[model samples]
Target: MFSKACEYGIRAMIYIGQQSADFGRRVGLKDIAAEIDSPEAFTAKVLQGLVRQQLVTSVKGPTGGFELTPEQLRTVTLKQIVVAIDGPDILQGCALGLPQCSAKQPCPMHFQFLPIRDQLNELLRTHTIGELAGKVHDGLAFLKR
Candidate 1:
């Protein structure tokens, strides 16, 4: 349902948030990529988009890296990250790839997919980075295979 970049972005955010909240440390791109099992270059691009959106903060120096403030970890929702990397259309796009798939012009799968899409949107809106990170930090979830 999500692009590779979006998937990686979500993983990267969760990992970064986990480190920042649990360990109280910033994460470098190389470490973030390794933890999420993504390529450094691609992760860099994804992180750049996130930084551009002000969803992630990038610092430069000997001890500098990437991190989210405590407020950001608590407030940044999955929907925000999705929209930042994949744009808002990913959540609203037609399941059948039709240009016009609204209720007025329903696609073949429109009705069947409506409930699923709404549920996904709600999940994204309600779950924050901190929540997911906590699950990982507590070993209740895994970011890697």
Candidate 2:
């Protein structure tokens, strides 16, 4: 299962994705943390990981923080965020942490789950960051979950 850290990290990213794209300004961590209701230090570290993964761009200054690069903005269909912060294994592993979960052996839910998982992966692979901004604007969908 995704941790609270994972949830907050995703929420932070979604806010940044919407903000930087709509407002054309890099978002500061303090502001993001406050908006998303996360601890400042913890959010800072998560933001750093996002930067390192090239999912976000960060600058150091009075008017700086993070914004998604044009390349990373609208991306996703995964139940979680990027594999860099979480791990690529989220795609292949069981959400319940089953040891034998796979197409070959399958965990308990596999009979009902593999197709949905594959669809989610395809969605993540096909979408671009810019695509998300439009969706977010249309319905305010990129909201914190």
Candidate 3:
């Protein structure tokens, strides 16, 4: 349901958050890409978007890399990341990809998909990167195959 970049962005965020929260360290691009099993170039681009959105911080120097502040780890929701990389439309766009789908001029599946979309939006809005990172940190969830 998410673009490849968005998928990688979410994974990168979780990994970065995990490292920052659990290990007290920032993660370099190479490490973030390796942990998430994504290409460095693509992950760098995705990270650029997150940095642009102020969802993640990027530092430059000998020991510089990427990290989320404790406040960001706790407060940055999946919805924010999704919207940052994929735009807010992903949460509200038609499931069938119809450009004009809506309540008044509903697509065939619009009414049926409304509740599901709402539930997804709620999940994204409430679920934080910290929560998912914690799951990974505790081995309750896996980011890689």
Candidate 4:
């Protein structure tokens, strides 16, 4: 599972991508938070990380906000967003919150959780934001009600 920040980051990215790919519009933190049903302050903080990672672009003043380039939309995977917000902990951390769990000193759930983690990593790596945005554009997926 992802942290609240990571969840907001993914939703923000997909929503921003949809705006770019479907409407050619830039998005503000308020708009994004509203669309994703996230708090504005928290969304802004999450987006700050994406901006720092160069995953999303931001600007100031009226008519200036955030947007992603076509190249970014096509290449920025959910894994990248996760790493940007949560680091590699989600993929490598112990399922039961054991800090020292590893193959040599395995926890009870370690073996059981490894394959599921691997599959999740693969799915996140392979799926780009563009694909998710395309789903939104086609009315196949949504970020909020």
Q: How would you encode candidate 4's per-residue C-alpha lDDT over 1-119 as one tens digit per residue?
A: 78999998999999999999888889988899999999999999999989999998898889988999999999999999999999998888999989999999999999999999999
Q: Could you report the Cα RMSD, in angstroms, for every candidate shown?
A: 0.8, 3.0, 0.8, 1.0
Q: How do the residues 60-124 of candidate 1 rate in per-residue lDDT, one tens digit apiece?
A: 99899999899999999999999998888768989987888899999989999999999999999
Give TM per candidate: 0.97, 0.77, 0.97, 0.95
Residue 37 lDDT (model 2) = 89
lDDT of each: 0.94, 0.72, 0.94, 0.93
lDDT per residue (tens digit) for residues 17-75 in model 3? 99999988989999999999999999999999999999999999989999989999999
In model 3, the worst 10-residue window by lDDT is 88-97
TM-score of decoy 3: 0.97
List runs of model 2 lying over 4 Å from the truth. Answer: 74-80, 142-145
User: Can you write out model 2's per-residue Cα lDDT over 20-137, one digit (the tens) per residue?
Assistant: 7788888888889988889999998887876776677898888878887655764542343556567776666676678777778877788677777677678767765566656776
Better of 2 and 4 by lDDT: 4
Better of 2 and 3 by lDDT: 3
Which pairs clash inside model 1?
A: none
Ranking by lDDT: 3, 1, 4, 2
Q: Given candidate 1, what's the lDDT at residue 26?
A: 89
In model 1, what lDDT does residue 124 have? 100
